[model samples]
Target: MSYQALYRVWRPQRFMDLVGQEMVTKTLKNAIITHQTSHAYLFTGPRGTGKTSAAKIFAKAINCRFSKEGEPCNECETCKAITEGRLNDVIEIDAASNNGVEEIRDIRDKVKYAPTEADYKVYIIDEVHMLSTGAFNALLKTLEEPPANVVFILATTEPHKIPATIISRTQRFDFKRITAESILQRMIYILDQKNVDYDDKALKVIAKAAEGGMRDALSLLDQVISFGDNNVTLDNALLVTGSVTQESLFNYLKFVLSKDTTNALKEIQQIVEQGKDANRLIEDLINYCRDLLLYQQAPEMVSDGELGLLDDKFKELSQQINVTQLYQIIDELNKQQENMRFSSHQSIYLEVLTVKLTQLSTNSEADRVSNVDLSQIELLKQKIENLQRKVDNLSSNTVQTEKNNEPRKQVRKNTTKGQKNVKINLSQVYSVLNNATRQSLNELKQVWPDLMNMLSVTQRAIMHVSEPVAASENGVVVGFEYAFLCQKALEDQELIDTLENGLDRLIGKVPSLVLIPVENWPEIRSNYLKQRKNGAVVIADDTSEQSQDNDDQSASTQPTIIQKAEELFGTDIVEIKND
Candidate 1:
């Protein structure tokens, strides 16, 4: 016997050995047992599933000369010949090459005759959907009402292409795609029977390489066995198909997840240089990203569904990132894949995409540094700072206000006209209180610079009232002139004591400080005269004037104390109503 490949050798000689189509197998067995077999049967599914194989088995069961129960008795000479494809009564036709009406007419003429040897004559047509409409019409009449011992079996990967009228005459069976686990178990049994020394990982590679096609899995195992030299390791299987090792893809994904684009891009380049199929990489990447997104969303529970080939590291990678971020990454990569289809510079596009993804992943990091707000916020804040400076200037004590439109300089100039022989002797007075210095004088400058300017021109002894004592124990009296009300308010002893102990103390010789009311100034002497004479003063008007000092500065001092206070303080003082 010539050498047969494992799939052809172990080609499911009996219905019991077929791997993942138990439902179809059971139904066929029951039909045969119940003797309810139809005249025409249609089997449809994807390639590598047992659609064609099932048709063969049905042919064998119906034709077996010594069949027992529902199954063909393989011990008999008739059953063995049928299984070995030597039966003259059964016909197997390939519709792909014989799709013409003449070929189908030959089949139509042959079905008219009775069975040669077997009880029933079975015509098995593979890829029957490939037949033209004329061919289907030629066979339709015989298919609907076939001879008593004649049966027609049509198998196709796509049943939808067949006309409904032709389909309606036949009983249809849909074969399901086999699962990876089911394919794996079958591959294991084959390897054990062949005495093949193979790793489980190699078996997994063959199973996943099948992608639900049992024939594809067998073909992969055959190819790997030829190159694998009796040691079917993962590396051998990977090399046979120019396929990437799952570990390489997983490692690159790990580097990508770490935001280490440098290594990830390098690894992907290595993969491309190895001549691995780029489409497979994309498909695996999409699956990887989907699993990661699912695991990220719900750590406690994740169903493996169709992606059972993914290993434990894939699950770990899935749980490594947030679901939302993973989805964004996958969507971006998918868009890149679509764009790559039209671009001639696919390598450059992939490299640029990798760099951009690295930059994006940096941005996606939970600990990403916030960017500095360089323009609008800082510029508006600067403008606010300037406005704040203006507000601060209004509260400063130096900028004094005038009641009317007259400038304060003009008022000070007019008030400077005083009697030369007044004999105030301010220095001699300040000597009585021990509160007189430039330190105190600067504060006087802060509030009473105009008055101090006037007093300095006279060269009299005047002192700023920083802390002038008034009790007799100090042998001094503290007083202030009408021009220096603001200067007198600095009589804070705690501040004065701190000043006296400093390097530049404001305290000087003791002085008897007296604060004179504005009326006592030489500018308003008539008001003083009325008060001392048990009399009152009259207000001056243009029509009537009781007393007028046309050239005198002391004519207006006769106002009451409350009137003077109101005039001096103006709006700065609040007057309470007694009502």
Candidate 2:
């Protein structure tokens, strides 16, 4: 006589009413029809997957006097009483609340009784995993061998918590999660039966949000229906589901693709102000990009139900962003999502994420530029001309300096008040450049960006403004654009480790890292070249006691190749054998 929830009103009463579990339903139905029903059964799956509903249907079907083809006839008093939960022969228990030994003992004591009004007595226990050890032990023997005309059905979302002995006693049926398509169809059928006007997109949104749970889908549909005044509209559905509209997501992503950070942040602020959760928004964006990528690879695989509408705008956006760019954006977003999990200042992280995404998009666009483009060719020509002018100016300056016999001003680190200064070991730099070959430097440069991509967002941002300028067999000299970033890179040991590990994978050896400001890089390279031109071999001077001791130790002990391999690859990767 009162208004009931949609899930409650439309609860599956028969095996045929259960959606997205044809195999489970068919197996249960065949068992009942063939009169070969097991005395005990264990049903396991995610919630809203129709485990309990199937159990009830099975109970009613086996006891219904007028049952046909293993289906319960609702007209019979037995099926009607069971469906209404008034049948004395059918019992349903919540193990979560009554998960003690005493409660199980009570059930164990009652299994000897015969059915009062039906041919068989059925017991359905939901959330059976919550039963304590003693309670499980108490029920194990009874479940293995029940009285005649008695059946027990145990259902749980987590089957792993059930002991192996308890699990071995019953016939286990694993229910699968319902698909979004199946949920959408079920919602449409319900809405049509109720004659409620609903947008197809609205149903799709609810279905995707349900994540394969029919009860959740119906619950969300109920909320949307109530919010929409019984009219399931797209806006109402999005509001109820706390989902970003496809249009809004498309617009935000468009700004990101265009590298428009200002507009993108503006869009994000609006979305957050509207009360959308940060983690949820990030998850939706990831899914949206995943759908876009799927569409890019195979348009037919992505349907309207999965990706809202998939209109002309969606197609156009997919065309604009290449697969590689999508991959970069997704990876960056996933990293940011993980970072935001424990973060209190989520909005700040989101702002930072927006900037990173736009930067990635810009980098990807630059990478896609054609090598034969006239603009790039012009840019290269200008750079070459500038280098030539610089060379000529240097030549003139050198002649003047020689005439005056003046020493060139020493290129030193420029430190200002409150400015952090990164200490670059000049001796180390000299050594790397001393042994640096063109081949090593080129190889480092080739894999630098790829290595940077493997780092976390903060590390990547700091390292992106740097380049591998010179490298040797044992070390690399990276030049950062700013002194602060250079200092940050020097202090971040994790970043250093990640870079070294990534490099080891990319190229076969792990080289130590040396960082310096880009402002001083040209001078450093120029000074090193000048010293080499003058036939001055630059080498690291051993000044520290540790260095002297290390040299002494090396002189005394000759390390075998196995020791070197162990040092390079770690002891775990190297094995030694007796000769």
Candidate 3:
């Protein structure tokens, strides 16, 4: 007897025998039980998921000589013939080859006939989408209003090409991929029955590589297994498929997260040097990222299919890479995979993809800085605020003493014939100035050492006199220094009485009055008589004698205030009377 491959030997023989297609099987079973079977059916979905098998079972059940509860009794000759493809009443058509209008016309003529032996004549058209529009249209009329005791079952991997008219008249069943668990369970059953030695991990890898197709999984197992071999291992599975382990991809991701470009590149180099498929490597990476995303969202769970083989460590790593980064990495890997098709340097494309991934590792540096936990930022802000408070306390504790409230007197230099001299006590004047003006005055005083602590400094004023006036009859006029001009103007009303009294009390005479810029002093007075008229005691207009008289006045004024105040308060306070 010739050998039968695993997939053919394992083909589902009944509705219940089909794996992972319970919905279709159950519906078909109920339909058969109720005798509510449709004349035509369309089964569509991914390959290897049992659309054709379901169609066959439905045919067998409907045509069986003796049926029990809508299930075929294999004991019957009619059911056995249909199952073995010997019955003329049940016909399986490969629409791919018989897809022209002429071939369909032959089917159209056949639909007119009555079944010779079976209760119903069934036509199963596989890959019906391959039929041309003319062929589809030719068959649509008979399909919509088919003869009694006739059934049509259309199957296709791609159904979009089938016209809506044909699809609507037929009952449609969309078959889905048999899930990993379903496929793996089936694989285990087959291996056990075959007495093939295998590890669960190897089976899982094969199941995953099949990607939800039972046929693909079984076919893969056949390729990987040597029937006489002791057992299958993860390594043998990896080698047969040219696929990398999820662990390798996970380690590459760890290197990527840690920004270990060198190690990541070296790993890729190792695989590239071994001549492993670069595109498959990218595919493995993308799947790895997918699992990582699942890990983060769904807890530490993985597929019993392939993920069961990986240890808990890979699962933990899966949780570390979140969906966002995983998506980004997969996007990059996909782009690199696309680039590899066109580029001559396949290894370089993979390297570039890894390098781009590693660059994202540095963004974690910025993340480290910005990720300063809210508590840390708050702590630093609080520390700054505390230091500010400390500074405020120190400043508050430091002492500052207020000066005396005595009027700030402006000093006046005695005018000699050839010298220009003017004076006043600054301290007395500043005491009366407003706060803002006092600050300006202090700043101005910095340029003059004597003025810094002095009561005042007099500016010689401008005056015009048409006639000479008696000294005792006129009151003395005081002009403020330039820096205090605004202060002097603001307090001009305040100084009237003080000036008049001080003139009489200190000089013992009411000198004639004038106020002017200090620069205009010489022109206001010519000699002693002119000075008395102008409210200045200009003894002579001669420049030489002016210097001598001014020297005598300073010698007298400094001692009276500084010397006396020094003895009284232990602080220097100079007083200069402008009168």
Q: Residue-wise lDDT of candidate 2 within 392-456, one digit each (tens)?
A: 56557745754564332232222333433355556778888888888999999999888988986
TM value for model 2: 0.62
Global local distance difference test of model 2: 0.83
Model 1 lDDT per residue over 310-351, tens place: 678876776676755666678778988888888776777667
TM-score against truth, every candidate: 0.59, 0.62, 0.61
TM-score, cand. 3 vs. native = 0.61
Error of 2 at 114 (Å): 1.6
lDDT of each: 0.64, 0.83, 0.67
Lowest summed-lDDT stretch of 10 residues in model 1?
A: 542-551
For candidate 2, the 10 contiguous residues with the lowest summed lDDT are 544-553
Q: In model 1, how large is the Cα lDDT of residue 37?
A: 90
Worst 10 residues of 3 by lDDT: 462-471
lDDT of 3 by residue, 374-454 (tens): 669888677756655654454344211102211222344333333223333322222222122434333333422322222
User: How large is the C-alpha RMSD of every model relative to the true structure?
Assistant: 23.5, 19.4, 20.8
- Candidate 1 residue 520 Cα shift, in angstroms, is 74
